[model samples]
Target: MALWILCLLVVLGMGFNMVSGQGEDPFGPEGGRRREMVPAMFIFGDSLIDNGNNNDLPSFAKANYFPYGIDFNGGPTGRFSNGYTMVDEIAELLGLPLIPAYSEASGDQVLHGVNYASAAAGILDITGRNFVGRIPFDQQIRNFQNTLDQITDNLGAVDAAQALARCIFFVGMGSNDYLNNYLMPNYPTRNQYNGQQYADLLVQQYTQQLKTLYNLGARKFVLAGLGRMGCIPSILAQSTAGSCSEEVNQLVLPFNANVKAMLNSLNVNLPGARFIYIEIAHLFEDLIANSKIYGFSVVNRACCGIGRNRGQITCLPFQTPCENRDQYVFWDAFHPTEKVNIIMARKAFNGDTSIVYPMNIEQLANIDIEPN
Candidate 1:
C-alpha cells in the first residue's frame, strides 16, 4: 500500500510540473495561455513605424544609429522613436513578437508579419525625394507582394491566402505627403493643387492603393489618420513663440476627413472588409491638452534635438537625449517617445469609440472572417 501511494504521489507531481513548465501565453492576459488574436500583422507607413527597414536603404532618413534607440532593448533599429513605435506596442498588446522590417526579413520571419515602412516615405512616390532614398507606398506594397509570393510558395496558395486574410494591415501614411511634399517650399505640389484639391488628389490615390491591398487578401485594416502636423516640434519651431501652426493644421484636416470617408466607402464596396479608422489627430489633441494627466511635462519640445523646442534640427549622431525622456512627448523633431507610443497603441487597441471608430484593433483582430 505504501509503494502504491508513493507512485501515485510521484505521478501527480510530474503532472503539476508539466503544467507549470508549459509557460504563460504572451498573446493572452498575464499568466494566461498563449493564443494569437490574428494570424499576423503587416505594417505599412512612414517614420511612425519604420522599425529597421530604412537601415539598409540609402536614405538620409535612416535612424539605425546612436541616440535613436537608447531606450530600446535592441538599440537603434531604424525606428524614429527612442524605443518602440506605436505598432510595436500594438503588436505586444496583440500577443506577438516585434515585427521584422521587410529589408531584413526572410523565410519564417515573413510568417509572423513584416514591416515595410520607410522613414520619410509618403503615399506619393515623389514626396520624399529630398531624402535621396526612401521606399514609397507603391514599392512597399510590392515588397509585401513578394512576401506573399514567398508565403504562397512555402504554405501553398490556398493556405497563404487564408493566412493573409486573417492578418491585420496597419497603414499610417500621408503625413509626409503633406509635410514633405505639398508644404515644402521647394516642391511644386502646392503650385499644382490647393489645399482642398491636394486633399482630394491624395484621397483619390489612397483609395486606389487600399483597393490594391484588398485585392491582395488584406481583409482587416487599421488605418491611422494624420495627426496635427502643425503641432509637431518641427512645425512649431518655425514659429518664434514655438506655437503650433494653425494654418498647417488646417491644411491636413480635410485629408483626415476624406480618409475616414474613404474607409467607409471601401468597407461598403469591398466584401468581407473590416476597416478601423484611428483618430490620431483627436487623440493627439487630447494628450496635448491634458499633458499633466498623461504625465507629460513638455509636449512642445523634442527630447533629443537642437535649437528651440528641439525642432530646428533632428537628433544628430551621439546627441544626448534628455535625462527624463518619458516627460517629453516628442522624441525628436517629429516622433513620439516610447511612453507616448504605448499610450497611443493602447488607446487604438482597446480605447473607447472616440479614439478608434468602427471598432478598435482588439475588435478588428477577433472579428469572424470567412476563409479566403
Candidate 2:
C-alpha cells in the first residue's frame, strides 16, 4: 500500500512538471538575463533548506528518494519538504534560479549560487554525529571557500569579490545542535552544560563562525533564529497529552537572544556587514496559534510519517503522505510542508520589523553596497 502511494506521488509530480512547462525558464528570457534582486545567494544550514547536498553522502540523513519531493516539480531532488524549501521560494522572489546543491553544482550552475545545507547538520561538528557523514557548519564554510576559488577562476578575482559582496549569505541552523545533540541521552553535552550554559557555548562558537563568513567576503547575511522547537511534531509527541514541552521551548530562548545580540555586535564591528535576524520563533508561534488564519487545519500533525501526529517515526521509504498536503503545517517529523515554507519565505522577504528585525530581505537586497 505504501509503495503504491509512493508511485502515485512520483507520477503526480512528473505530470505536474510536464504540464507546467517546468524545464522552460519560468523567470524570463534566455541567457540568464533576468533582473535579480541580488547578484547571487549562498545558503548554509540544515535539512530545512537542503536541496540535494546529502544525496551522495554515506549518511542515513538523506531524502533523495520517494515521497520527499512528491509535490515538487523536479520530484525527490533531496529536499525534505513535499515541495520547495524556503530557500527555493526565496530564490524565486529574488529573481534568481533555484540555488544548486554544492555537491552536484559546477560551471555556470555555480554562477547563480550554491546550497551547502546538509540534512542533520548543525553549528557544532558533534551535534549531528549520530547521523554520521554530515557536513558540519565549519565544513560548509570551507566548501564556500572552494566555491569562491572556483568563482575567481571563472570571473576575475576583482569581479568575483564584487559579486560576493552583492550576494546574500543565508544561515538557518542551530536547531539540530540542540535537538539532536544536547537533548539526546547518548551524548555527553547535557552532562557537561546546563541549558543556559549550553546556549552560551553555542553562541560563542556561532559568533566566530559568522565572523569567519564576514572575513570571507560575506557582507549581506540573513540569520534565521531558532523557532519554537517545543511545538514541533517530534517534541509534542513526547508528551502524553501532546502538549508542547515548555522546558525545550525555554532552552531555545537564550540561544535566540544571544544570536540577536551577536548579530548586533557583528554589524557594529564588521563595518560592512549587514546582518538581518529573522524572528522564526514568533513567526512559527503565530502560525501554530492561528492555523485557521493561515489556511491550515492541521498545525501539529505532519503530512507524512507514522504514529501519533504522524511524527513518532519520520517519513519512510514508502510511507504515504496526507491527501490534503496544504492543510498540514509540517511535512515530516522534522520539517515543514512546502506550503508553510512558502509562507515563511514570503514573510522573511518583506515582513515588518516584528518578523524580520531592522529590515527584511527585500530591503536588504535593495541596499547598495558601498565599497570600503
**Tens-digit per-residue lDDT, 1-372, candidate 2:** 121121111111111112354333333446554667776788999999999998999888999888999999978999999999999999999988888898887544654677999988999989888888888899999887765555355445554455567778999989999989999999999999998899899999999998888776778999999998898888888887888889999988999999999888988888788999999988898898889988999988788888877779999986888899999999998899999899999999999999998899999999877424
- Give the TM-score comparing model 2 with the true structure, all chains together: 0.90
lDDT of 1 by residue, 1-372 (tens): 121121111111111122342333323456353555765788999999999888877889989888999999979889898999999999878877788888887543543577889988988989888898999999999887765554355445555455566778999999899888998899999899999999999989999899998887789999999998999999999999999999999999899999999988988889999889999998899998999999999999999999989989999999898999989999999998999899999999998889998899998988877544
Q: CA lDDT of 241 in candidate 1? A: 92
C-alpha lDDT score of every prediction, in listed order: 0.83, 0.83
Question: In candidate 1, residue 142 scores what lDDT?
Answer: 88
> What TM-score does model 1 achieve against the real structure?
0.90
User: Clashes in candidate 2: how many?
Assistant: 0
Separately for all candidates shown, the number of backbone clashes (residues 3 or more apart, or on different chains) is 1, 0
